[model samples]
Target chain A: MSLRRLGPVAALARHAVLLASGALMLIPFVWMVSLSLKPPGEIFRAGFSLLPEQWYAVENYSRALTASPLPRYMLNGVLVCGAILSLQIAICAPAAYALAKLRFFGREGLFTLVLIGLLIPHEVLALPLFILAYKLGLLDTYAALIMPFAVSPFGIFLFRQFFKSIPDDIVHAARLDGLSELAIVWRVMLPMAMPAVIAFSIFSIVSHWNDLFWPLIAVRSEQLMPPPLGIMAFKNEEAGSDYGPLMACATLVVAPLVVAFLAAQRWFVEGLGGGVK
Target chain B: MTAGLTFNGINKSFGGAHVLRQVSLDVASGEFLSLLGPSGCGKSTLLRIIAGLERQDAGTVAIGGRRVDDLRPKQRDIAMVFQSYALYPHMSVADNIALPLRMRRLSGMQRLPLVGGLLPGSRTTQAGIAKEVTRTARALGIESLLARKPGQLSGGQRQRVAVGRAMVRNPAIFLMDEPLSNLDAKLRVQMRAEIKELHRRLGVTFIYVTHDQTEAMTMSDRVAVMAEGEILQVDAPQVIYADPANRKVAEFVGSPKINMLPARFGADLTHAAGTTFDVRARELAGTAGTLGIRPEALHLAEAPGTGIFTGRVRLLEHMGSDLFVHLDLPHDGEGGTLIARLLAERAPQIAFGQTLHLGVRTGRILVFAADGRRVQPDPAPAAVLRSYA
Candidate 1:
């Protein structure tokens, strides 16, 4: 068939592939929500239905909230993620500014080191980090959880790329305007790179919120546990798997991210693809 | 206070390439000077050096007779407007204009976002700065644009804001690096006059860098013609145009460019384009040289005679006020071309392929030796040409 005649068929195939993958990705969450609303007798039934004949949402959610310290876990999640994002920005922006704007010896080698840092996963350093935290007497505390991810290589890389695209003239103008180098970062570069900041914040928060590996190794106390660790604790405390309340807790943990992503979806796309105007 | 500036033996290099060499200049207080050259010719580099934006490898710059070599850009008593305007993209126009003053007048603690205004004296200082910003905006005719971001303003409005920012500081000197280069042609012409007027009103020593000769000529008290990292000539605009120091200055300063004819300087006469003229250079005897002639110096000769170049008219360009006739010289082995600018009314009968005799006003003939240095003609030949005219 001619190219013009094949256009509709091609579009239909493209959308079919997209919808199929999207549904594949969304099935687990849908199933979690479905299971959270079904009682014990309906949960194990062979026939699959999205809605339960007997509603169990209130009982499961209340149990998820009260039987364990779910609110405390979420608050811990908020504190850890907020602290990590703030520390990351404080450490990374200056480093990124130096890499992007300042001319000095060994800048290229330093940037290469950062690129190599990006190559190694954080999981590889968990053992050393745990031992270091033990020697520092910070284990089972928020310090242990917040310290490791503070200076994010990815944050530096993202910010440097954004700052490099900003004209040197602006920096020069800032210097002439009598702003110190650090003031320029906060007053000029950071504000101008707002989209990149939003994009990086989303990445940091989502990855840390869903993070199960390092937090499992770092903190052991019930109060210090974030959501995923708390859910695991709740499972172990109960006699059975307790699928209804467990799925409800999972739904709660995932809801904030969904709302946040929806609210900032526009900035995320712009941050990834665009820089200053 | 207005102050004079001086640079002594400034030299700069980047990655082993020399960008400037032995560059030196002096500007009197309240005088407007332009560093004029093509791109990469180091005019902007020199201006940056003056503003302390770029450090020269070996030099001393004195602003108001104080050595500024050790100072940072902010420490120097000068303000610069960049070619890009470089307005802070996130700030309102009022804040942008107020920043320099704020940096100087306010304490560090008083610059905080939320708690800043609560500091003692902060409110009054801020009010003073706001009033000054409004006054500056009004002077630039951008008072209505105070609340808008730099991104919201048009190129011309942004340009005015940048100028206002530079002006509010009231530095001893003003440095502008091709500030009008980003504007469209019509707007450029309009801004050119405004900048000149700004200089007149401020009466501050202004160092403006531009590649456009017209901007340099029309706006500056003196134009420093630069090439290959060195200032070739610094003189009044008309002098630089009328009496260029060398071939490069002659070629660079005017539109339609000065025409250069390769000539052999013999005992008594100069032979060029199959025509002999009573043009002799005493110091350039028996050597090859060039005869520089402006387009307006050539008039229509009634018939072929001495001191006249004979060629065939190849093209005519009608620029409403003046007619430019392009002639092809047959005798030059390279097929040399010459352009003679005439009044549109005088060249009414000229047509393509017509044989034309163009008489040179020998008094205006500029002679240069093979090395591109100007050579004064023996006054005798110019007198003969005057008699002929």
Candidate 2:
């Protein structure tokens, strides 16, 4: 082919590939929505339609909400996730500032240990943590659900990296202005590191909100169940049938994370790219 | 307020390597003192120690007659202009200049975005800070750029903002660490003059740190020459140039460094180059010393008897108003080459490969011991051993 003719073809092929990958990524959500609208008999039937012949969304939503106290489960999830995020921000912001700026003894060693936490997966300590929670008689409580996820080593590490990229002279200037260490972190460093903190908050909220393992291990009471655990109850209570209600609950579980990501998308990218530049 | 500043026996070490060893100096009220040295010579470290950014292992730092060794940087009443001009990227020029006062005056709850304005005394304090910032910005001629962020301003403008930020505090001492290092050559010169003028106007003690000797020489009331973490000498610029305490100070202060020639002396008080010379040592006759001569101090002698050394001119570098002639001396053993700086008017007739006689004035000739210490002329023959030893 001529060079001129080859250019557009290459561009078209690239676009086509991207469009196909995008559609593939959306396939699972599309199938779930389609299955929710289908009747029980037609859900697994051959020649399944992407669009349902019958409209059952209203019934499916109503049944899902009424069947297993999903609204209450969602509220529990929000509280647990909200508590964890608040604690993480409260703890990590100052810790990050100290690691980035202050000159206390054993600071670098402590920071290195925190970074070592990133290398170990949470599963390695899951059983020990559960046993500890059991010993404290904290089983079936929201504390068990929120406490494990509260202290985020990754969040501290991220914020520390972001804070280190800030010029030390500015911090010195702040110190020279008579701002205390905490005041410097809260007033100056926190405002400057908003993008990283926001980005890390989104990461923390999404991961903790979507987590089912710790919630499953800790809380057995139905009233204290988070949304993801509630989905299992919705599946088991309504038996092997009723694909409609299950899909509705699943969609509901995914909505908050999607909305949050959309809200903080700009800061998310900027924060993730913070120290790399 | 009586004594401006004093760094008494300040010592700082990193790991095992000592970066500053017993560095001591004093600055009087309204005096401008410069810590001048090469890179890694610990000049910046000394300034930071004075500013309370870095702590000395064993010493006391006093500002305005108050011991500030344990005090925080703010409590010490000092303001520093950094080399990078570290203006806050997110804030406008006005807010940056107002930050110090705002932090001092406003409480935590009174600094919140929405509730701060509603606080009881925040409004008045905020107004006062704004007025101070406006006056400082106007003084720096950066009032028009107040609303712009640091990224929006040029380098010179950013420097002005940095100065304005430091000026708003009106602290007892101003510590500047290579503040003009980031500017271009032309701008550095212009800003150098501006900083000198600012110092005169403020009439506050200023401790400036720089590796550029010209910047120190042209601006400071007294220049402290530092090398290898130790201050070699501190004096007025002209005094330092004319009378250096050691060979290092002699070589560091001037352009076209002082030339050193190894010479041997005889028992009969006769001192000659390897070939021959009329120069004689009346005192400390049998001792060996390195003869130090400035490039401009050597003159072209018309005859053989008046000159001390004879050499053939190898090459010539034509500067705008002067000529630098490279000479090849047969007696310069293993010591690469000798340079003679001559006036352009007298240099035109001197051609390459022509043998010329160079004469150095006896008064301007600096003699150093083998250890680089200046060898002074001894008054008594008995004390000559103590002096030359």
Candidate 3:
């Protein structure tokens, strides 16, 4: 079936607007890449330029790799994001299933409380979380970086909507087939909810990987710093003029996520509507 | 050994909406019973209660002479085929059929992914499950489809896989909730016959639920008709259709529906629906009632002024074997129209707007009171004769 009807000129006009929007979305990344490839002095000299006059790509990338604990920061970023995403799924999936399917007394009231959580942004809780981490002696530790994001209300809500779309008969059939509620969650519902999980994985990993606010406030040591905080600190300590290595480090830090997203984009894009199909 | 199942005083409510009310039923072992009702009539809910999926608010459910109200669904030794088939899309037909057996026979560790394979004795249990699955699949004639996942199969194939799953358990009872509703008309008929034969071959208690009267009438040993959360009648399919216990059951079980004409019963003669016929009324003569006629009971007369109903043909629908005649009565008060199912060969070049006289056979008229309960008089002649000859 045809989804749209457009005359050739009208379609051309629509494509023009969409192309401009697409270019606009990519402009910052383009500028970052351009600055990363240019000689260190040319970054300061450039008013606006798409390409670098002299390619310092090898030197900038090599230096970015060698400089000041950047690799270790990337490793820590992976560890923190992986831990946070896995923990978020483990905690929220069953909770989401219960919220979507189970018939407890205060199910609605509890879900309302979780919905209210969406209104309270992470920024609102950052101060209290910092204080709590400090009191717990978790400052400068991976726990502080990973622990605050262990339960995402958005993840729970997304999974709950996805789980709700699954027919209740399948769950009842599983029950009659001798599966416990937990077995139904992991073995039955989880497999069916893979698309939702993939979509949520993208959300969790991207958000936690690029997060700078919590990491800057929580970590004091360079050893445990995530890439964003590490690169920001690297800029402060490095002679303020070397913008090439900084952008290159930023590129290195963000590349894994961009590549991973591109690899899984088909399912991620289609599955974002909160269903398997 | 297979055993009978019973629900005593079953009642349930969702918030303030009373869904099932004092529903009590008993099923003999090896009997195929159907709970036929329209949507939201609590037939599905009652079926779930029988399967131990839904808990009754105040009732005792007994399976195999044991009260199973406290038991979990798995403990109840019953299996169900959902209307949606509920086949795990990720699992192959073989795995879908084997799931129940594996869960029952294998330990949690033995059921794991990689570690389960390495565990001792897991191989033997897995082999045994495969054998049983193959046997069940072969029985359902779906052995060729066992290797494919449910997503790859058609609706009828998925239905067979579901039955194979339930069949593998060898449970004491089989509960099916409109299992054929998803299929088209031709497939529904074919699957209905298969289900009936399956019930005969299995010799286990089968409780089926559906809204389709044809399915219930054609397949079940007995049908329990329900409406508004209460059972109206429970009888053999033939009996339920021929002699429904109430107006609701009578109206619900027939195609084109039973033509019920509001009438008055007095002096042992029925008068209404533009036709006057003698009928024995169980109540007093002054009582208001309905005169019910099945479509087959009405036949075309040779001429007007000779038949009970004289009217103009409003519509005609021709089936290959039979024709449907819709007639507009002469004096229409509130009685809308009379519809008759006649053989195509018997209809004489009938057309819309043609005047026709219709005659009802003696002993074919059914009577109901103003409150819509069946009222049969002594020495009634219009009741269906169950021929013993």
Computed on C-alphas against the true complex, the DockQ of each candidate is 0.82, 0.60, 0.82
Model 3 residue runs over 4 Å out of place are A1-3, A45-54, A237-239, B300-307, B332-336, B349-355, B380-389
The DockQ-derived docking category for candidate 1 is high
Off by over 4 Å in 2: A1-25, A37-42, A53-55, A119-141, A220-223, B1-3, B265-284, B304-309, B312-315, B331-335, B350-357, B377-389
Interface RMSD to the true structure, each candidate: 0.7, 1.3, 0.5
Q: Write the per-residue lDDT of candidate 2 for residues B206-289, one digit (tens) a residue.
A: 889999999999999999999999999999998888888888998898877778777665443334454433234545466776
Candidate 2 clash pair list: none
lDDT of each: 0.92, 0.83, 0.87
Docking level for model 2: medium
Per-residue lDDT of model 1, residues B1-389, tens digit only: 99999999999999988999999988999999999999999999998888877899998999989999999999998999999999999999999999999999999999998899999999999999999999999999999999999999999999999999999988889999999999999999999999999999999999999999999999999999999999999999999999999999999999898989998898788887778878878789899989999999999989987778888899999999999999998865345999999999976689999999899887799999999998888877445446754
- Quote the RMSD, in angstroms, for model 1: 2.1
What digit string (tens of lDDT, one per residue) describes model 3 on residues B1-389? 57899889989998899999999999999899999999999999999998888888998999988999899999999999999999898788888999999999999999999999989999998998999999999999999998898889999999999999999989999999999999999999999999999999999999999999999999999999999999999999889988888799989999978998888777866677655665667564887888889999988778654227887899998888989999887666454789999999976778889987888864677778888888775554434431210
Summed backbone clashes in each candidate are 0, 0, 1
Ranking by TM-score: 1, 3, 2
- Kindly indicate the candidate among 1 and 2 with the higher TM-score: 1
* TM-scores, one per candidate: 0.97, 0.88, 0.93
**What is the Cα-based lDDT of residue B68 in candidate 3?**
94
* CAPRI quality of model 3: high
lDDT of 1: 0.92
